[model samples]
Target: MSERDDEEREFDLKWADGAEQKEPSARARMLAARWKENPPGPVPFRADPEHVGSRRRSSWVSTAVVLGCVAAVIVLLGYINFRAPY
Candidate 1:
């Protein structure tokens, strides 16, 4: 074999010896241990009294606006179809 072929084989052999895996850092291990003792609890739910009424009112307004838009589109399409020569 040529020198190039020998050098290529040597490189492949060296590369095949994969890198060693590393353990978690000290901070990561500490956090894991701490959570094991006392893990997080479920999130608490909150109710806003003042905003509830406004939210319902805005929902009704939005529904009215969407319905109005649909009606306008249907009327415009009917007008277009009626005006079409074909």
Candidate 2:
């Protein structure tokens, strides 16, 4: 929720001092009010371009390392199969 929305929200409401803490009903009412005021939706997130680019580069390097290891295993198995003594 944004700052303006926060201001409009009614929270920690008190009917009387030392009242029973039946907060479930109050929470639902507050949620209903906020829903009517501002419907729920996904919050937009924007990452810094430089940070994203750096992460992408690191991911690519890791992928290449994994593929290289897989390729080495396959080559070793092929050589072993060809030279195995029955």
Candidate 3:
């Protein structure tokens, strides 16, 4: 309101809270255009020979671990229920 108040506040009210948006950079716009022109195809399976072996090994190991955990839980529950005087 006063001359001192104007000096204390220099910010404009036009874009006080709104963000200043900007267009994408040249490289980003070029990549977007290229992607639209040549969209990617469906991903291929077993693309690498090294990955194929590890992937198969991991599945087998995971299955064995899951089965072992389930068996242990069932055995523990059965032992606990049998020993309990109900």
Candidate 4:
């Protein structure tokens, strides 16, 4: 084989053997240790006061839109099924 072919084969074989394991960096280890010692507090369940009204309003709007679409489909199907033949 030529030099290039031999080099390519060596490269493929080296990667095919799988990667080597690596130790975590000092900063990563320090952060992990700190979190272990003092974990974060639980997340809040309630929405913020300013956002609460908007969230509720948007949810109601979305629900009304879905119900409107469903009602339209139902009416269209009923008219198609029961309408007189032309």
Candidate 5:
């Protein structure tokens, strides 16, 4: 608003060369892409048959096999008994 204030403002802008004196940061980067890292390598492992789920499946299979054999034996005996009179 006064002549002295305008002079001080012009003096401040006179130091604009100071802004260009500094260099940009070397480590600064732009437009970086994001990435999700995959596992380092293939796993050297196999599924264990004794795992709980595997054990249950194996138990059912064994149970079914045993029941089938018992049924077959029972039927064989009954047929033999029926034919003994012949």
Candidate 6:
């Protein structure tokens, strides 16, 4: 085999065994052990109570505006169709 081929083969073999002989570092092993001892629980949602009333009021106002706009458009279209020369 060529010299370059031999060098590539040596590199591949070195990495293959180098990885197998490795273990997790001290910090990683400690974290894994601690996680096993006390795992985390699901997070809870938190909302501010002071702004809840204002938020609800704004939502209702926005809904009323949207419905009013839709009603106006429907009436305008009906009038246009009725007055059209067909």
**Candidate ranking (lDDT, best to worst):** 6, 4, 1, 3, 2, 5
What local distance difference test score does each model get?
Answer: 0.89, 0.82, 0.84, 0.90, 0.74, 0.91
Off by over 4 Å in 5: 1-50
Q: Estimate each model's TM-score.
A: 0.49, 0.46, 0.49, 0.44, 0.40, 0.47
Indicate the TM-score of model 3: 0.49
Q: List the lowest-lDDT window of 10 residues for candidate 4.
A: 15-24
Output the worst ten-in-a-row residue range by lDDT, candidate 1.
13-22
Residues 3-58, model 5: lDDT tens digits: 99999888887866457675545443221211123334565497665576978899
lDDT of 2 by residue, 1-86 (tens): 68766655534233343466645588899999999999999765988677899999999999999999999999999999999997
Give, for candidate 5, the lowest lDDT window spanning 10 residues.
Answer: 28-37
Clashing pairs in 5: none
The sequence of per-residue lDDT tens digits that candidate 3 reaches over residues 1-86 is 69777765544434453558857889999989998999877887647787889989999999999999999999999999999997
For 16-82, candidate 6 gives per-residue lDDT tens digits of 7788567888998998999899977876586678778899999999999999999999999999999
Report the error of model 4 at residue 80, Å: 1.6
Candidate 3 shows a clash count of 0
Angstrom error of the Cα, residue 16, model 2: value is 24
By TM-score rank, best first, the candidates go 3, 1, 6, 2, 4, 5
Question: Which residue pairs collide in model 1, if any?
Answer: none
User: Residue 3's C-alpha lDDT in candidate 6?
Assistant: 95
**Candidate 5 TM-score to native:** 0.40
lDDT of 1 at 8: 98
RMSD to true structure for each model, in Å: 10.3, 16.8, 10.5, 9.5, 24.1, 10.8
